[model samples]
Target: MTDQTVPRKPPRRARGEGTVYWDKRLERFVATRIVGYDDRGKEIRKRGSGKSRSAAMEALRLRVRDYERGLAPGADKTTVSDVVKDWILYGQGQVDDNTVKTREFNCAHIDAGIGDVLLRKLTTKHVEKLLRSMVATHSTRTIADVRACLNSAIKRAMARDLVDRNVVELVVTPRGTTGRKSKSLTERQALEVLTLTKAHWMYAYIVVSMLVGIRTEEMRALTWDRVDLDSEPATVAVWRSVRKSGDTKTRKSRRTLAMPDLAVDVLRRRRRDQDADRVKAGADWKDTGLVFTTTLGTALDSANVRRGFRSALGAVPSVNPAEWTPRELRHSFVSLMSAGGAAVEEIAHVVGHSDTSTTERIYRHELRPVIQTGATFMNRFAAVDVVAPDWHMEPLFRLPGEERTAHA
Candidate 1:
């Protein structure tokens, strides 16, 4: 009798473990799994294809894991671009229009670098590579903003479970190209600018900004109601700004500044000029009640202020309009105050900084290199002992324990 050979049966896969089959047409292994039941009680299936059975099974495992974590079908295919665009469209709420535009512009850099990359597959290496590439052309601030944009977008994705973690947060920001440093006008240049821009439409805006150091946004948002020109000391409230919230940038920024003679005079002239503008505009005036406005009484946007500022500065032969911005006027204020021996604390208060450190850090270039307060106070005592070369009179104050004159 011939010995019978028993054929072994293939091992059976556990229920819901999925099945792998070789496709003759595609010459590849494909894996399929029933991820869920549809609304109609039919199996909702997901498929993963690979060149080999193990590869196909591994791919299907990733899909099943993502689905089990509560991610919707097709979540594995979501791209970084999709996540950023979704965040830009829906996550930001009640931000300024300019802020929205700025984020959109910054996100473009990310999109160009790795926007199409799958969100689930994003890694710290990918983000670091993208930022390092930008280091050559973008400023440090710009690079930082781009990283922040990516971080925020990933956070939004994580909140929705589109990403397991934020790869951007793990990547360190690379040092980027140095940008142009802010500069201030010298005393001579400030005088020239003031004299030259006297007849310009932005004269009051220029005067108030340079002399009082109010931010451009605050200057634009100033209104007649906030002006107290009739008080003992003329004052302007720095209580509002052109931001989306219409509030000051910080709690310290909401201060009531005593206007100088120059600012008070300029604002009076501005009010008179605005009345004339309102008369000329007739029915077209929008009555926005903004201290700075166009002929039609509408609020002046940043673009309008920038263009007018450049035009006004163009009249100054010493100033290059293209090289200067309106914000530099505030820098000039800090420079002049520091040069005139004003304390950093005083300058900080005038500029409405949250603290003196902020003023010192940002305006360090404008501050006096040598601390003169102590030296200045000590000089008074030194001068009391040293008689002038041409001295011919008695000392103003009697020295301690000095003998009285016989004539007394």
Candidate 2:
């Protein structure tokens, strides 16, 4: 009893060899393995812990498998929130600032829902639940975007072998709240909207949007240099948008559209009006070169354009300002053109869509399919409502005792 040296608990398992132990303090079983070394030559080990022995063993097995596959041990503890933040930082210069801002918003929403979940443990059920939770509060498009953002983030994590699979892709996004469908004005309504908004400063904006079909972002970012009024057929170069990088939505969106007479006239008048404002503002003018601007001449933001559009809508009695958005003008343009018998291809070309499928999908209600004479053949039968019953039919040939006079 005098020399009882507590047999040093079987010298802790050697490095690189994995081990499992019960942690009294954590009240859990932990599995650990030596992963590698940091750049500073320090040992980088991975730890997996769970309340149950089997759970800890399974986690440890995953850790060892991932390490053998040359994945970073640091990823074992990485959370969805951590991945999202890393992706945001890594993606800064890859996309436009507006896109980055939108991604950040989407990620913030994702974080609020399931950000605390570990990347390794993220599941399809977790993502589906997140989307369903958002259905009541966010638009379907917004929920779709959130899914896209998280999918992209998890994909990046996968590329780094931080996670095994992208659970976001496995889940079908739930149907979200119904959003306002895009609608076009009737021809009479279109004429009224144009006539009513004519006296406002944003009159040209409405006219060009309706007549030329320029996107709101493209119009807001339009510069004097891109507008050509003196050319035999006036045109506006549809090449830019208010995106921080000044890129159009797509390469096909970088197009030159011929202006309608109404568009040309309105644009010319706007040039003169802007010139006058420039003189009035003098040194205070921002000189942003944007086609749309505030009184001080700085570029108009979406809010400014939206407020002006609603104000313009105030002029029409039948239309509610709250019911319409600026983008609807472009929709109205497609509808009006389709109603006027414009070809789908022509409409798509003018709208800067990459293909007719996009134009058709978006404006299906406005488009009429080409049919020749099927209606003519179908219409005659629609009037045969008074067919005589077989019982009421006269005999095809009269018997010998039938009345003689044809007039009778």
| TM per candidate | 0.81, 0.78
**Backbone collisions counted per model:** 0, 0
In candidate 1, how many Å is residue 82 off?
A: 0.8
The reply for model 2, stretches above 4 Å from the true place, is 1-60, 92-101, 369-408
- Clash pairs of candidate 1? none
Model 1: per-residue lDDT, tens digit, 66-89?
877877667799999999999899
Candidate 2: the clashing residue pairs are none
Question: How far off is model 1, as Cα RMSD?
Answer: 7.9
Q: What is the lDDT of candidate 1?
A: 0.89
